[model samples]
Target chain A: MMYSPAIIAEAVVNGLMTGAVYALIALGLTLVYGVLHIINFAHGALLTAAMFAVWAVYVAFGLDPYLAILPLTPLFFGLGYAVQRFVIGPASHGSDSNILLVTLGLSIAIENALLAGFRSDTRTLNTDYGFQVVELGPLLLSKPRLIGFGAAVLVTVLLWLLLSRTDTGKAIRAVAKEKLGASLVGIDVAHVYAVTFGLGCACLAVAACLLMPTFYVNPRIGQAFVLVAFTIVVLGGMGSIPGALVGGLFIGVVESLCGLFLGDSLGQIGIFLIFILVLLVRPTGLFGAKA
Target chain B: MLEVRSLRAGYGGTEVLRGLDLSVGAGEIVAVLGSNGVGKTTLNKVLSGVLRANEGEIRFDGKTLTGASSADIVEAGLIHVPEGRKIFPNMSVRENLELGSYRRGRERRSANLERVFETFPRLRERSGQAAGTLSGGEQQMLAIGRGMMAEPRLLILDEPSLGLSPLLVEEMFTLIRRLNGEGLPILLVEQNVVQSLECASRAYILENGLFALSGTAEQVRNDPELKRAYLGM
Candidate 1:
């Protein structure tokens, strides 16, 4: 197929922006998986729930979407902690599959609850900046996309620093490696698990708030992003923060290029094809170690 | 000082350590020796708070530690280097050592890191390398070094010699002796009866979840039953 320079440039920019959001979504799932050893299938539904929460706050109080995140994060953090402590913790029992089932059940329960509560209507955050666009040479960048990308990068960087440099971060890493050994070294494994899940949910909180301005929200919308996030998490290596960042961006660029060169349907299939290829080449992903 | 009385523990319905009693004096190197499946590791697990006792009293430095959380137990300076290395395979050697002091050693993390490096200089040279890549001997040294980073008053090592080369096994014994020389008490759990008895001041022989024999290392070493059962002499 013949490719125009303008089309390629637009595709690249679009992919980068979409990839940023995917990174944010994957960040939490990977973190939870690293420490808790659970796939956390409900993670996508949680993001959708957070989006709806933000939407409710914005539509009711006329608050800025960004400001809604401030209160929303701590709220979701508490929700995540409780979910782990009360629901997920008992079921875990050192079984990986059990946790997966629990999370999958949670995903279904959450999506259906949202469907029952809000119906299947697509709702977008109608901020003034939502429609605003910036033109640089032949490329057009939406204001919301730019802001979402920035927020995703900022949050991911902050999480990386937290996991690498902080005391709590050390404890989280310890538990991830060896729960019994971490306990022997005086880390509360249960507390670490709860807090890690909370932090992961907090990422979704930020992603949901920032993304509302860029995309429409509905009960089933979580599936669209969750699949991409899972692919990024696996591609980046399960627990590697930097890997997630690079993987997200890489997937975004590929998706954008594919959409431009191939059709949209083919582009998604191409993304999955890449996911399978990465798994075959390196099961641990780019940064992950073997399980 | 560490004292465990009537400590009862097991996995799922099968009691591995049934009302076991043991004590280790300050600055003493005591070994718990037994053949495979005698619950030597189970005793370490109960002592380190990794497994809760079904019934018993555990006192460390006169503080009742029964049912206490593992983190609290570690904070109290009771550290356990588990049976397997259990090191964070993905983390660098330095990171694994640094994590050793996550609870109570946070203040002296750098200092303790240096001390561990001194104890296992090879780890210092490969501080940035992933721990899983280390040779078995080096991994054993890393495990011991990680335990040292906690500044443990009473260290429990569960099979530090397991899967080590003959030369490394000798080195492991020497390292235990050196750590004991520094006034650090150790509870060495092992199936290598003869070697463990050589380094320990006191030795306890466990059989079927009970202490079959207990005395000074010399006395336990010369026990005819132990020699017949374990040494195959």
Candidate 2:
């Protein structure tokens, strides 16, 4: 197949746009992994819940998805915090497998609850301005994708600043690096874990809102996207923020190019190939420090 | 300032600090010395609330601390500078020190940080560097400095001199003495028999999870059994 330069450039741009949302989803996953040392298989389910919650708000109050961010994000943050404190915190002291089982159980329960409540119907946000396009010389950028990408970059930079500059952020990172060391220095590690989980959920809330315009939400939406998020997390190196961004973009481009050149089904295959290659060649991921 | 009575603790079924009794008075430096795996570190872990005591009572600054969360223990100012220099490897020296005051000394954090820097000039010089990147001796200092940041009422130094050079060991002992001279009570748990005895006002020899010997530093240092086993005197 002969591809023109314009098509290639369009694929690259499309890849970056989708990659931004992927990074948003994976950031929470990696943050939880870093501090709690748990894989948080339920993270995707949590995002699905956030998507439904935002949709509910939009439907009930006729609020824009972007405006719903203010209320839904904080509410989900609290929900995440409570879940960690009351639910995950107890199992966290057990073996890694214990947390794994617990989170997996939670994921199943959440998906079923959504299925029971919302049925298997696909919910889409009917926004007025979603299809509007912004042109940058040769490239036509969809308004929703541009906004999602901007929000992703903004959140990532803000999270980086929070982790590097603030005392609470330092405490979270400290707990992530060394639990005993954190406690020794008077850090309430249990509390940090809960907050980190909450923060992770908050990121999901933001990602859910940004994604509402373009993505269709269903009970099993998490299952569809979470696998891709995991790929991004590993590709970006387990706890590195910048790695998540770059990894997302790489996966995005691969998906777009493969879909364009081969077929839609082959794009999914291409993603797995890259995942396997990264695992085989550099198990630590791109930015992961030597374990 | 610190007391433990009938302390029975261990990893799981095997008891490490079995029915042990010990105490540290205010403005005193007490050392608990033993060879590796003799439960010196275990005692620190139990005291710091990391390991649960099967049956015992621990009183710190007139309040019972047994079974308290590590956070509450540190909040009460009984800081444990754990063995192996467990500084946050990914954090800068400054951040490591700052976290020391996270619970107890948030108000005077800057002041305490300056004091810690003054105490360990090397840590101050490398304040921006990651704790993991520091040399062994520097890491040890950072550990102790991080401990000091909490304004500990009674500092517990667990094997501070472990993996240090001979000269650095001497320097560590001297630093311990200097810290103690400031009227801060310290519970020094170590395998270095001689230096610990020299710096500590009193010493206890732990063996097989029990205190085999206890006396003034001089008495424990000159004990025939101790000399035969530890120093080969």
Candidate 3:
């Protein structure tokens, strides 16, 4: 393949944009893991569901795609809270594997349900910004990609502040580190778990809405992103927020580079190869502590 | 300030605390001494609302706390410093201390932080260090300092002396006595019988989920049975 300077610049720009979106996705996964100590396997499916919900609102009510997220976030937040309280909570009683199994089942059920309700047909948001592109010297950026990237960064910063500065955030971190000690200090572990799960789902809802203009959505699309998100979570360290952010961006750039230098299919294979290598070399991930 | 009556609790069909009773009065230090696996930690768990008691009544400041949540218990001013010095490992010493007052001590956070720093000058000196990196003795101080940040009415210290050097252990006991002297009621749970008895006003010995001995520390210390079993005298 002949390499062009313009193409390389475009690839790098695209990698960063896509990396932001991936970080948004992985942030929720990492947050839930950090506080709740469970792998929320259904996280990707929840994102898919949110995407479909946004599409449904757009189709039924003719609401703007961005406007749809306003109502969708709280709706999904409540749903996430309920899911943690009822389904996930019970499964969390025993071994960690129990919660894993339950969430996996939830993922399967959600994907199939979306498939039945919305069909397997692909969908995209019709927005003025969807197809628009802006030029910045040698690099060109899509409007939606720019907006999504901005939103991702904003959300990541907001979450970081919340976890580090606020009382609730500290409570959540305490629960993540030591549930027994948290309870001893009068931190409500159950409430923190519910809120953390809700927060994670809310992040997904936002990511899904932002993602609409940039990518096509379908019932099975979550299957495509789930593995990638998990890979990001694992690579970033299981429960580290900063790790997730850096890991997501790194993966995004790596994928872009692979696609540019290698074939597209080989790019994905290369990403997985990186996952395997990371597992062998730094099992705790780049930022993960030895728990 | 606190009383646990007929407390019974367990995990996975195995009962850990079976019909236990204990109490701590205002400005007093009550030590709970026991061998490992005899439910010293379990008593703390039940009293602190970390574990739900199967049958018992826990009264704190005349409030029923048996089934209350841990946050509620903390809000009620009953704080528990758990075993193994469960400080937030990744957080800075200051952040860990700040979180201690998370539920009910938010308003007095800064003042309490100052008080904790004064008490454990080492913590103040290394307030920005990650708690996990602290030495075992320093971690124990951080744990107690965090507990103090909550402005607890009745603080429960569970095996505070565990994993400490003999010198640090003495220092920890002295700190506990100092805190008690400052008019805070405390429940000190430990395996170090002699020091615990020396520091506590009253003492309880737990064995097989029940009180094996209970009296003033002096009386309990002088008892022939306790001396033989615990002191190897």
Candidate 4:
């Protein structure tokens, strides 16, 4: 079974588009982990909720999913901030394990809540542009996916700028490295933690908007992406932003190529196989915390 | 000026600072000298508001800060340069300094930064480099220099001389003396009895969570028990 170069190019392009969204999903996860040192098991559930928000907005107001990004990002940011500041912060009480358990419980609670409200059926917005495709030489790329890749890149760049140039970003990095030192400088560790968590959820909202056009929404839809996002977080290193981005793309390509050779269902194993190999070799992750 | 009355703090049934009373007046270099595990760190933690005092009143510039968070303490201009020189390892030297004025010294950042660079010219040379890459002496200098960026009303340096070479330790004291000469009150917390007494206007020898001896530098240095226990006289 020989594949032509055109097929390979198309596969690579497809992989990149998928990988871009994966990176966006992972950006939030990595940022939270970087600052809070929490695994954030609720991430997928949060994504599911955001997707539902997009679906509800579209169904109710006939608004475009792309337009929903504006309001939802801030809305989710507030929700995440409140959850971390009021709920997670007090409940965790300065314990790492407690935070992890809380996030896990949050994930389960959110899943069940969404299940009760929306049921188990998958829902998707059938936008006019959803079926459109871009003809790129020998490749016929899905328009929404192409936009997802470009928007994802734009968001990544913006996020990078925010973290590098803003006062809040500096405080976040400071707290991530040294909590007591950050507080000593009047950073208000709890505030920074909540802000980081908010930024993370905001990223997920943007991702949900982009995903809704071409993807389905369900209580379990996010579960499909969250595990890969976690693997990307670990593969890229636990807290490194660039690591998550690069790892997401790399994993996407691996999955695509493995599917090409090993079939789709079995190709999923490619991600885990690489994850194991990376763990065995680097241990800290690629671009992880700077060796 | 900063004042503490009978500060008592501990961790989980093991009391570290019990009934400790101390004060630092304006423009005074007050040294709290204690050996390892004698509650110097605990005192720093309590003052900085990282650790809560069990029963005490801390008045800084006439405002109670005993129950305040570390942010409030910092906002009150009681900057703490903690032990182990906890500089953000991955951030650049310049960033670490810039973050010093994050709450209080924002208006004076450029000027204070210029002054700090002038004071620590070596730090200026490596301002663009990662702080973790700096030598121990430089990191200690960075920690103190960071506190200076805050323009603190009272600067607390916890074990600033730890891990420095003997010559560098002397140099550190000279640096502290110069900083104090500029009329910034300092709370010099250390285990270095000889140099601390030399640099401080007054000194207190802390032992077993309480001050065993405290008075003017001359009085503490000439005390018989202090010389016998600490200096092996």
lDDT (tens digit, per residue) of candidate 3 on B106-131: 89889989988889899989999998
lDDT of each residue in B1-233, candidate 4, tens digit only: 89999999999999998898899999999999989899999999999988889999999999999899988888889999999988988899999999998998899999999999999999999999999999999999899889999999999989999999999999999999998999999999998999999999999999999999999999999999999999999
- lDDT tens string, model 1, B1-233? 89989989999999999888899999999999888998988888888887889999999999999998888898999989999878877678888888888877788889888888888889999999988899988888888888888889999999999999888899899999999999999999998888998899999999999999999999998989988999889
Ranking by lDDT: 4, 2, 1, 3
Candidate 4 runs further than 4 Å off: none
Model 1 spans > 4 angstroms off: A1-3, A262-267, A276-284, A288-291
What tens-digit string does per-residue lDDT give for candidate 2 at A1-291? 888888789888988898899889999998898888889989989989999988999899998988888998788889889888899779666578888988999999999999999999999989988899989888888989999999899999999999999988999999988888887776787788889999999999999999999888999998777899899989889988889888988898899899888887887677899999999999999999889
TM-score of each: 0.94, 0.96, 0.95, 0.98
Q: Pick the candidate with the highest TM-score.
A: 4
Write the residue-wise lDDT of candidate 1 on A175-269 in tens digits.
Answer: 88777767777888888999999998999999998889878899998888889989999999998888888899989999888877788877877
Supply the TM-score for candidate 2: 0.96
Q: Enumerate clash totals for all models, in the order shown.
A: 1, 0, 2, 0
Candidate 1 local lDDT, residue B202 = 99
DockQ of each: 0.69, 0.78, 0.74, 0.82
**Once superposed on the true structure, which residue ranges of model 2 sit more than 4 Å away at CA?**
A1-4
List per-candidate RMSD values in Å. Answer: 2.1, 1.7, 1.8, 1.2
Residues A166-209, candidate 3: write the lDDT tens digits.
88898888888877777777777777888899999998888888
**Alpha carbon deviation, residue B69, candidate 3 (Å):** 1.9
Please list the residue runs of candidate 3 whose C-alpha ends up more than 4 Å from where it truly belongs after superposition.
Answer: A263-267
lDDT by residue (tens digit), candidate 4, A1-291: 889999888888888888999999999999999999889989999999999999999999998999999999999999999999999999998999999999999999999999999999989899999989999998999999999999988998899988888877888999999988898898999999999999899999999999999999889888889999989999999999999899989888888888888888887799999888888888889888654
Measured by lDDT, the strongest candidate is: 4
Better of 1 and 3 by DockQ: 3
